[model samples]
Target: MEFMQADREACDRLLPGLRERLLELPLSELESADSPALALFREYGGTQLLIPADRGGLGASALDAVRVVRVLGGLAPSMSVATAMHHFSIGMLYSIADLYGKDTEIEPILERVSGEKLLVASGFAEGRSNQGILSPNTVARPVPGGYVVDGAKKPCSLSRSMGLLTTSVAVPRADGTNEMGLLLLPADTPGISVHPFWSTFPLAGAESNEVRLTDIFVEPTKILRPPPGLTAQLSELEEAGTIWFQMIVTAVYTGMVSRLAALVLERGRGAATDRARLLMAVDSAAMLAEGIARRVMSGDTGNDCAAAALVTRFSVREVLTQALDLAVELLGGMSYIQSTDVAYLTAAVHAIAFHPPSRTSMTDALLDYYAGKPLVMA
Candidate 1:
């Protein structure tokens, strides 16, 4: 679901005037066969794009974040992914700083993040990690000063310009269960190396990677608070927050859907019947997405964040597929032209339809959640 166009006005006020100009520029990068989208993050001051104002940030909340991004994402399908990635980093850091790592030493970094001085991206994926748990196969062995992190993280968005690397590494804790620790590895650190090139079909604008950490020493201060206890509190915490991030992700895909819907209406405006129903579905899906975001942002503790994520994703999936079908059916032969937006529109649908947190796992989780069983297969 996407936000109403009018809602974007309030969301825009959170950022400086520079955002509009940035959005207006042509940023088709790889996805569009041009300059990479990573450039845009640098233009917007990276992670500082939407920090909350109260904490020396842009003062954006969940819904505001959703509205502003969905609008831009609808406009620039390829380039917007990088923008959204930077925002994700900002959101995660801010949330983490608030919950655990509160020492004043972090304030300066937080300030830099708020000011968008450095770009950051998540580095949690590992060769053997479970996509659902976000566990990393990387290992962090404690060293004299800090720890040596060694392993590869796959498909890290913005790996090139990312100054700060936030990752999860397998750290054996006192408890029998393997504990995952969050580590901050600077991009310039000696042993850290990123593959020179990266690309994804729909997110051509953003640069992702196979990130390698070869026994790199990270200072003790760099580690964010170790994830909360894995047993009880953390399990529940992960369950709650994971869906929220997923919801944020849904906005990117549906944002594009909203744009396609608008175009269909503009093209058909009283001209066709099939296109009208498709447009209605797209518009309705966008509204539903916005509603879910608003509920979460409003402090509704009862929000089924995961459920919303699952339902929203499935809805958007159907919305895009149907929209594409309608485009082809209504436009007839014109839609088949490779040069037309019809192709990109449908390609993007498939792109997000299969984005990480794969549909199968999402459905399984949703089923168990609704069935009220233990969330895992024994």
Candidate 2:
């Protein structure tokens, strides 16, 4: 009946020894740019957690993945944020493979991901302000065999350590229009480079830098095009991607807040009622995320599920924000002045509001969906 004990045990079972190793390091080191958390994650087979067991991977359920992410967020916020991007991209790729079967050109690459433990970084428009989540910032020019991609993803997580870069691009058609497509390229491919971008100290270890692709040539097979005639609105793949992104990212932040809640209880910072409220806030958010994961596992990753995921994410955001404030207050000024852990985690938890489909941007869309219209992300 301990707080988050089941999830902690799940983390131990899924990625044995990672939590202990991460705990052995100081929080300052674990949150810094030079942190070894990502390396330790890869060494412990963290990359294979979502690749499906039959495909040479763990094939963890959506619920298990959320639990594992919650544990990681508590230990290393940066690693959880960076790996969320990786998992989102992996989920999209593997979903495509499942729909199309073994003939996918990306099948071997996926095999490498599960078999070799390669990390994939997502380059979606989520980082850009006032843009549709499905919009492509990176441009791709059609060539004889493939495309010469040109653009950059500022604040792309896992930029420094990713083995593969999967990005959304606007591909120009011969008929004088553009279509959204997903492109997969090796991280070391010619003309692909990473540069300094993320300047904030919090989550600095995530390597959220600018990844510039200057005329990087990719083969035709490497680009995943949406089925024809679906350009006017969100595609099924885009829906799934959104759901996965929102669910996993929410879980990561929830875990971060859970850490603060844990500290509050351990120190017995307040009266019985106060302690119960703090734990309830954090646990409620955790359960909301789990609800979305259950929906995904039930094969309902369409517009309704996507909307539910967004609702859960924003709801958790409100709940956790209050919980964070309460935990810090209960911890008192002495704890704040004596150590940086409370301050650091509080700042990190605020980052949940900055993630994609931000509340401000999604307000009108959500209203329309509530009025019985389809959920739209534009």
Compared with the true structure, what per-residue lDDT tens digits does model 1 show for residues 310-329? 57767777776776566555
Q: How many backbone clashes are present in model 2?
A: 0
TM-score of each: 0.83, 0.95
Q: For each candidate, what is the lDDT?
A: 0.61, 0.89
Model 1 TM-score, all chains together:
0.83
- Candidate with top TM-score is 2
lDDT of 2 by residue, 1-378 (tens): 899988988899989999999999988999999889999999998998898888988888999999999999999999999999999988878876666567767788887888779999988787676666557979988888888889988889999899999877998888999888777788889998999998888999999999999988878777777765655334687788889999999999999999989988998998989999999999999999999999999999999999999999999999999999999999999999998888899899999998888898889999999999999876
Among all candidates shown, the one with the greatest lDDT: 2
Q: Model 1 off-target regions past 4 Å?
A: 1-4, 7-11, 15-36, 104-106, 126-134, 174-177, 196-201, 225-233, 269-272, 301-303, 328-332, 335-340, 374-378
Give candidate 2 misplaced runs (Cα > 4 Å).
129-134, 143-145, 227-234
